[model samples]
Target: MSNDVKPGRAAAIKSALESAFIALLASGVCLWFLISETQASDDGDPAKLTMLAIGLSAGLCAHFVYMAIAAKRAERNATLWVILMVVLMPFTSVVLGILLFNQVQEIEQQAREEGGAGSAA
Candidate 1:
């Protein structure tokens, strides 16, 4: 399948980066909440527990970003992987952004080749 990003969609890169950073921050905040709860002599507050759970889960998702990066690097399953990540956790947008950045060199090479070929004709 073609790997070309649709032309004129630069905003997606920015969006992904923003999403990733948010996810990371949220996860960190949640961890802090959990720690505070623990320090509080097992307060048993559902609200704190809920935030802790969510934060830990989101943090787990950060590791999954490698899949997104690979899929995009392979240029075969960006949409599918990206969608899965997003549906599973909103923070995965950062993964997408990281993938995009990681793939830039390859993308630039392909563009140059295509451009040269077109010019040669």
Candidate 2:
């Protein structure tokens, strides 16, 4: 019921944003590399495309990890989310991330309300 804000909440948000930015930057760099290295005939090369795909996927996976970690700090199940992301890839993870973020917000709001009520009493 303390009115003081949870210190980790802001840190968690900042960490999540930083992780997402890094992931996006990594993906963009890979894309740039792909574009620069593309020979006209390389478009047909399965290996090159496959490597690029892997790089992009890795970046996406990192983003998932960051989100999962942030959600975990907010009391979500980290292992479950990580496994779900790995098994189902981006789609399921994205959905779960949204749910987790909403849940975290609700939890924070509830905490604030309780604190305010306690202080007013």
Candidate 3:
């Protein structure tokens, strides 16, 4: 077999990135809904309130996903319930992504210190 290094990221990191991306999308959708609701209200539309609520919910869900990712990556000492609650919020997914990035940095530091530690047989 040829000695070719595999180009891949840790499974946990991939999951965290996925979660963060989804949350970002949700946040965008939520923002759009909020704007639409505001316009509807200006036009005296009865659906404005419902649209606003939808936007709020989307934002909340986004936050929770991020929090969940952080908790799974073992980078944060956040409580299960709190992480769940936060991850479900909008714009919070980005926060989780940032934290995960920080964790990766820490991992890199450890790897340097250990000098190729934990090599597979």
For candidate 2, the 10 contiguous residues with the lowest summed lDDT are 1-10
The runs of at least 3 residues in candidate 1 whose Cα sits more than 4 Å from the true structure, single-residue gaps closed, are 1-7, 55-99, 104-121
If the candidates were sorted by their lDDT against the true structure, best first, what order would they fall in? 2, 1, 3
The number of the candidate with the highest TM-score is: 2
Clashes of each: 1, 0, 11
lDDT of 2 by residue, 24-45 (tens): 5797787776676675554556
lDDT, candidate 1, 56-112, per-residue tens: 786757635544544554454767865777686545555555656556545656767
* TM-score, candidate number 1: 0.45
Worst 10 residues of 3 by lDDT: 1-10
* RMSD (CA, Å), each prediction: 6.6, 5.1, 7.4
Q: CA lDDT of each candidate? A: 0.61, 0.69, 0.57
Off by over 4 Å in 3: 1-9, 48-52, 80-96, 105-121
Better of 1 and 3 by lDDT: 1
Q: Using TM-score as the measure, name the better of candidate 1 and candidate 2.
A: 2
Among all candidates shown, the one with the greatest lDDT: 2
